[model samples]
Target: MADIESATAQKLLKAFMQFRKTGWHDKKISGHNPSEFKVLATIQQGANEKDYEMKLSEISQRLQVTPPTVTQIINNLEKDGLVERTVDPEDRRAVKIKLTPTGMEATAKARIRFTETFTGLIDYLGEEESEQFADLLTKVQHYFSELNR
Candidate 1:
């Protein structure tokens, strides 16, 4: 318990807080927030993999968010003319979601912007450090994931 207040622990906490203050996660890619873009990307990927519309539950599972949260995001995207929902042909009770042509265009642009942003980050960090950073981040994520369990 005493080690929790050590200089190293304090530095780590401060650094994490400073990182959160950077607003990287809050920044919009294209006209949508990162979460929205992620949902869009997931649908796009699902389409590529299955050649079919994604179900709301599938999106929720992939994004690790609640169905209601996904519904809210889908509602916003639909309102923006970016996505559309339809009844599943094989399962009348299920709703399937697909990107609109407008959604596809926006997603393409957003993908480019997202890649460019990360590319800039990689360039700044250089290859070796960027790789190390990615590995460290993965380790940190796994640690926290395990901790939560």
Candidate 2:
């Protein structure tokens, strides 16, 4: 094999480019758009039935987007009956966002669809090979986390 630096990036970039579309297509069972579903999923992950809520600042940090972008998405979600915003009791200026029943259902369906797709995909690999691939991917994730830190 050529030196690692000599390798072309085209293949890797193309694969990543196709990732979103492929995952979206796989989650077609959800009916909601993939991006909308993602927002709901993110919020649901942070908030639970007991006391689930987060402010725009927290969302912006988690999604790595501007507050405006998060607001736009939330606005659409609120219209679609997927999310709602409440004035924080402790801090009148802060708003807390939470998922609606519809949003939770959509997220659950998308998760199931995604899992099914992933399972279908893993069927192509042998046990040892799949484990090795998972380990490598985990290492890459840790590498990025370290870089961010």
Candidate 3:
């Protein structure tokens, strides 16, 4: 039992390292630097057009950073024309962030490149093995998430 657990940990660590290396993710994905891309991605994920646009507080929470840190990133994104800041209609004290069309385009490109890279690697593994591998990783993640909480 101990040996199996040890092997699982080793396997997960190896896969994480491989992802970090193979991710080859540069900051300059869309003519924007890494920081800019990160800010754009965060806003893109948090924003909902029809509903409430994401608040700066929400961005800070998602990034696990401080409000000031989120503000700095948002400022840069605003300058790049990837995002916009609007006065929150419901909350006079908070501002909402929304993605501009350019931001959407850049985020889409980044998602595509990442998916293509992931698909290329998955293509090398057989179907059953790939399914087994995914299942095992999911179990490992669940285990850690449970322990951490």
Q: Residues 1-149, candidate 1: write the lDDT tens digits.
A: 54868998899899999999999999999989988999999999999999658999999999999999999999999999999999988999888999999999999999999999999999999999999999999999999999999
Q: How many residue pairs clash in each candidate?
A: 0, 0, 1
Q: What TM-score number comes out for model 1?
A: 0.92
Best-first order by lDDT: 1, 2, 3
Compared with the true structure, the alpha-carbon lDDT of candidate 1 equals 0.94
Error of 1 at 144 (Å): 1.9
Local distance difference test scores for all models: 0.94, 0.78, 0.77
Model 2 misplaced regions, further than 4 Å = 1-29, 137-149
Off by over 4 Å in 1: none
What would you estimate as the lDDT of candidate 3? 0.77
Q: Over the stretch 13-70, how does candidate 2's per-residue lDDT look in tens digits?
A: 5666887666655454567666566677778877864457888678878888888888
Residue 143 error, candidate 2, Å: 8.3
Best by TM-score: 1
**lDDT per residue, candidate 3, 1-149, as tens digits?**
44636988789678888988875665366476666667677777765434436888887887788899879888887887878889887888998888889878888897676567568768888677888889998998998999999
lDDT winner among the candidates?
1
